[model samples]
Target chain A: MNKLMMPIRGDFVAPRFDLATEILIVQYNNGTLLGEPKTIIMDRASDEGLCQMIVEEHITSLVCNGIEELHYNFLLWKKVNVLDGIIGNWQTALEKILDGTLQQGAVLYPDEREASSYESK
Target chain B: MFTPDIKSLLEGIPCPAMILDHIFRIIDMNRLMEAMCGHVTDEVRGIHSELVLRSNVGNSRDRLFKSVMETGEPVSTEGDILNCYRRKIPVHYHISPLSNSENVRSGLLVVAEVLHVEEIKKEQSNKSFSSAGIIGYSPKMQQVFNKIPLISQTDASALITGETGTGKDKIAEIIHNHSPRARFPFIKINCGALPADLLESELFGHTKGAFTGATRNKAGMFKLADRGTLFLTEIGDMPLQLQVKLLSVLDDKRFYPIGGEQIISVDVRIIAATHRSLREQVKKKMFREDLFYRLNVLYIHLPPLRERDVDIRYLLDHFLNKFMTGLGRNIAGFTSEAMETLLGYKYPGNVRELSNIIEYAVNMCKKKKVGLEHLPGYIFEPVADSPVAAGDDEINHINHQTSQPQERPPSLVVLPEKTPESWSDIERQMIIDTLKKHNSSRKLAASDLEWTRMKLWRKMKKYGLLP
Candidate 1:
């Protein structure tokens, strides 16, 4: 069984990996879902605590939004598959990820056009 | 929670601005900020505000936007906006609450203006602090460096707060060094270091016969630091009664001698620092609220070393170079695995802890490159359930010792009945044999046994290996 974790905020991928106060853990066995998804709400934002959770739970893969290069490289060194820079609704991101349709910097929100559009000052 | 197209509205602001959530996550940043920081808006959104604004004054509990978000008010402060090229553009920023159409709070909107305040940023005084060897290029530290120039020109009572090893004293010295009063004496006293009477006498001069030891009139830190700066450290540890006197001194620039009727006056710039939160101290009545307000004119917060994750590698190399030559060791560098361990370790003691670890490694390393064997094992034991393995030798030994049928039924393998004493004797013999095998090198023996140096030393002492 491959365990996957994703740091989350409200309904989207947490903007910053270290400051994520909520997370989701999903277990899969050979592309089959193992059980119900679990959400762990941390009492506070702690990068070290999050990393500890990943190791303790034996999570093999992670999906996050913005992570500093130091942590990104550290997780990679630990052999965790990191799909980084992904934005939008975290549930959709997870759905796309389980099917191997997730891109490195995909914006998966329903209103992707508005989220991407910006007016310069 | 923001309104529809809040990012577009934020980008329409005339100057550099950003929208941050309650946790200070970058909800969005405008084009000017993107241009200044050289981070793509799409890629940068959701990062911590510190990564983008690089505000030197913000900590976990003490940020301008945080205060605004909490109190539902706006705050305007002077800060240095750090750019991608390591350039600091002195800026004045205003952080206000971003509310939804229903008047419900959502996030914060921060607007900044580039300041032409070149006079304050001038290379003012040449005098250096007695302790001025602060070195870090982390965005937070760079913000701190930028703040010194801005705050030094003023005589505001700057409150420096952080964990114990965050160099609060050094920052106070930096402020004094860059200030106009750099030529005068910079007196510092830790309120918690001395008894109440002595602390009072130290802050305010005492007359002859004031106490049993008062044989002559003694000048206090306020008197000694005349026309200079007086750094009051651990102000939170100061007694409540003394807090009133300290507040009066800050209020009038004068204080009465401990035993004399005469009120002694002095010209001094105040710079106080504490590791504890003055606000919390006030709520608990351990620190006076009025006194905290007096000292909180300009606040500077130092983030813990672990939060400055990018700087860990740089600091490791910097400290290694610093301690290696001094320790008379030619340790080249840390191996990648060792560096990874250091990077992953959340240094609770902050920068000072890291320096000690580096120095210890430098002193212990026998090879050109410092490996896992040179580093302590306990640094990696805090977060994991797996015991820290020094190397493959330790792993092999642990595997050997643990593969003795304990996991299976007792009938699986024939074993002799042994008392605890006999087991200790066997363990002792094993340690001695391992030591002999490694040429009496305790470090290697400890590695082979999968124990910390201290733990191995205790076992060695129990076995009478040390005279």
Candidate 2:
């Protein structure tokens, strides 16, 4: 079976091992936790294109330290698995997960459901 | 036979209180209760407690009431949002088992009091604070506001000069939102908000090993704003030494992020704003003159609120309806006297201060309309006295020089020694020598003569051979 694809933070410089086939590592600015940090030039087919790269690159998993809920859901809907709370060496992380040595920490999904419940209380 | 005594006992409790019989029928209500629900008392009295509290009769309130009746226990609940006579209000309800001297369950008594509606409105308004974020429509503001879209039409740097709180940041936002690169990124850095070292690191970013606290490589504002627009607010506060480096970036879009050897090439548009006069800062040696000129291209000056007297009333109404809706109050509007006072006072904090004043009045108002009584105490006081007579004289001199042409033909009765004339004059010879040294370049000649380009152009156009 094809392994799940997750994005990793750019600062996770070391290569760690996990069950996933490969880690979709990325570098981005603060506040924008998913996808390309740039909003301009992303929709186009020319240089620095965003959508084209996401589709053509055969990306499957995104492992990051922190990913915004919007981006996490977008990746998941695109047939990509999102694994977060992983930092440091990418290779070691992958090996630890593959060999059952890494303690998979809890990944936080933003409590979007609580936002609407403010009126209830 | 004892029912009359029981009803009298229930009416003695203060506040809007109600008592219900064993069948959940309201037996009696207090004097305050009658005044509060005066017109609707007939329909409400002798009605089942459930019927009075529950209009739809099928919602969560009914379910809780049924449980309270069956269990024979006093139950209290809070915040059942309901639409009462087209006004949204929250009510806290209390239900208790009615008992006689024998301690047997007779019926249930329910009571409620209306919480402060203003408090709920305040919370709601906090959620909608983006009203004045930037939707200006006044003609004077429109003139400046309209030019914002034009800012993003080109990559050339723009400088916005205005008094504080004139919506300079909003103007910057308009430029970014309307630009060709709007979707990319628009980052703003307040130059005066930080110290020199911190500001530099924020603009240029730093490498992991660049500084003491540098733990990881960080992207600077310029790099983050790459391929987009970077708004630098309060540029006048930038240190003189940093001004030189910034000028180099304006001259050539190249810079090395701190501690990194890579020469990053960024296609970024710069939009800078300041409350201080850059020209004055340059003269004071606080700002670099060359850098000032570089950013001065496509200059925009926002008139202070005092100058745009027409916007006060319009903004006042705008803010009132805005705050009222946000506070969830059907406030008809501000009283004429209150609005007049607002218009007469010169807003030292500009539009921001005006919004604050309206917000403050809205919170303090007990009636539907804001009045002079609700106005802040300071609005009525005389403005502070001032002492800048020397500065006033300098300002007058500037105005005087600006009004009259600098190169007007020497007064008809000019002093012969002061006005040099003649074909072979030393001044004329020196002009020719400098002109030749500049290789006949008008720009170069203007620079060498220490004159404005416009002045040199006029001179050349007058003398001919400007090309």
Off by over 4 Å in 2: A1-121, B1-138, B384-467
For model 1, how does the per-residue alpha-carbon lDDT over B212-288 read when each residue is reduced to its tens digit?
97876777879878878999887879988898888888899887889988988899988887766576677778888
Clashes of each: 1, 29
- For candidate 2, lDDT tens digit of each residue in B1-467? 45557556556654445666544545666655554333244445554443233222223545565576678777776653222211223455666666677765544433454444433552365322134365445556666755765666888999886656667888787677666666456778878877888888889888989989787677787887878799999898998878887888878898988899988888889999887767778888999989988998877766656666877887888888888888887777778898789989866556766776787788789897899998877668754321112122323322221211222244322211111222224345555677899887655776888875445544544332232
Cα lDDT for residue B424, candidate 1: 55
lDDT of each: 0.70, 0.57
Off by over 4 Å in 1: A1-121, B1-131, B383-467
What DockQ does model 1 achieve? 0.01
Q: Once model 1 is optimally superposed onto the true structure by TM-score, how far is the C-alpha of residue B330 displaced, in angstroms?
A: 1.4
Question: What's the CA RMSD of model 2 in angstroms?
Answer: 26.6
- Candidate 2 overall Cα lDDT vs. reference? 0.57
Q: How far in Å is the alpha carbon of B288 misplaced in model 1? A: 0.9
- Docking quality of model 2: it rates as incorrect
CAPRI tier of model 1: incorrect
